[model samples]
Target: MNNPIVLNAFRFVLLLLAQVLIFNGLNFMGTINPMVYVIFLYWYPIKENRAVFLLVAFLLGLLIDIFSDSLALHTLAILTAAFARPFIMRFCFGVNYEFQNFTFKNTTKIQRITYLALLIVLHHTIFFCFEILSFSHILLILKKILSTSLLTIFLCTLFSSLFSPKSE
Candidate 1:
């Protein structure tokens, strides 16, 4: 699993299954769903070509859209977040991002959390925004985005801490 390629491939499958089979059903208060699949994009090797990375991000979201029947909502949100990922990485990790993959071993805990939190918020914000195309439900959409982002961010941060290796 240390092999980055093999690891990310497994993540794709694992996260897709988890998203569709598990988290998809765990909607809280009928409005919040934890998006664990975005973790794949978060942890992909930084050295890979940027174009390919964006393609993978779009395809990953498209896969979820297919299963969840959310049309292009997932694809749009995930792609946006994926496109913004490099910028966010630079913001969070700065020069160290050029030298290594995004991982817990090299990055500080707060930085890792901030990185994931920002992406989650972006993803959820876009997701809820598209979901409510009309201003009629502005309040509801805002509420969903806020609550869902918070829950998803917390879970993502916890997952990062639990699964990512600590620095030696």
Candidate 2:
């Protein structure tokens, strides 16, 4: 049961369903949409295998795009986030980051919060950028990105805190 394939497959299905069913319908004021599905990518193991991880992230986003009829916006955003995650993790965890099993307790809450905030912001920025696809509505797109990124970060962090393992 040490294989990450089966574990990640299960996580992918669960997070996808959650995103499409629960999160998709939860836009506060029609402006705040949380992309909780990216949590799966955020928590994925093995920071060393960048190529495989990006492929998985792309596939996950493609699946969401297929379901949501949003074209490749999700795919692009997710791939970007996956590609940027290792650097974010390294910055957040410093020299202690483990490629095999990274735990939240290894870093301070401030660091974890910073990591989550940056990743969600990056993901939402890319998503909203392509979603708007127009410089004419730059202000509107920026609003959407800011609002949605905050909501996503808030919700994701709250949920993560609930299940976070206490340090021994």
Candidate 3:
């Protein structure tokens, strides 16, 4: 059960199911969609191969796109977030991120929250931007980004805390 591949595969299936079956149905005021699947990117091992991570990210997003029927919006947004993850880690964790031994468990609450918020916001921004595809509806795009990001961030933080291994 401790195998990384097995664990990640389980997580991928679980999150994809949750997103498609549960979160996809939730549309608060027809704006918010809690994309908790992005947590896969957050929880992925920092030391793992970047190409593999990106490939996993692509598959995750593509599946979401297929399920949601939103064209390639989710694919584009998730790929961008995955690509930007290292820079976001550097910004949030500072020198700590450079260490090979770094883990989210070792970071302060503020650092972890900042990292999650940035990723959620970045993903939402790209999603809504391409989704709307119009600066004429810029207000709509910004509103969707803010609302969705908040809900997604909260769910992601909760899931992370609930599932993270305890430091006995």
Candidate 4:
């Protein structure tokens, strides 16, 4: 059998490089960017250690921050998503869901979308909140959150639908 742990590590590296080297540069609409890179965290094996999850999240965010030069908001957003992952997974898979086998191929598209939607919203929420900590302009924050979330959802859904395995 393939070692899932090693496979995930390999995935992490490949995805990170893709995000940093290519995706980050593709500004779709000025500021409404689609960060599909965070999907790595979203797809991480639920059975893995929480500490490892958080550490990986922090490092992932750090890399984005370094590459994007954006005041660590990416790290903060990813870490928040990491922290909330268990709860999200539980909601998506039910309380009895097995983490090791959680996957889009095994679930309905709606279930997958719901799971990803919540995390995408949560991630953008945390990210923009930090971006607007001063709370100086309510309108701008609302606009950014809404626009970014919409764009991100569209892109993530597109990618998930395209790449998800054909069969379990």
How does each model score on TM-score? 0.90, 0.88, 0.95, 0.86
| Clash totals, every prediction | 0, 0, 0, 0
Query: Which residue pairs show backbone clashes in model 3?
Result: none
Q: Write the per-residue lDDT of candidate 1 for residues 1-168, one digit (tens) a residue.
A: 667678778888888998999999997888578888877777777788999888989889999999999999999999999999989989998877776454557667788788888898899889988988889999998888888888888877777667774332
Per-residue CA lDDT of candidate 4, range 145-165, in tens?
888788878887887667653
Predicted candidate 3 versus true structure: per-residue lDDT over 1-168, tens digit per residue: 678889899999999999999999888677567999989988887888999999999999999999999999999999999999999999999977888777777889999889988998999999999999998999988888888888999999999889985631
Give stretches of model 4 more than 4 Å off.
Answer: 98-106, 165-168
Compute the lDDT of residue 158 as modeled in candidate 2: 86
TM-score quality measure for candidate 1: 0.90
Q: How many backbone clashes are present in model 4?
A: 0
lDDT agreement with native, every candidate:
0.84, 0.83, 0.89, 0.79
Please give, for residues 66-112, the per-residue lDDT of candidate 2 as tens digits: 98999999999999999989788788888677544556655688997
Which is the better candidate, 2 or 3, if ranked by lDDT? 3
Question: Number of the top candidate by lDDT?
Answer: 3
Lowest summed lDDT window (length 10), candidate 2: 159-168
Give the per-residue Cα lDDT of candidate 4 at 164. Answer: 57
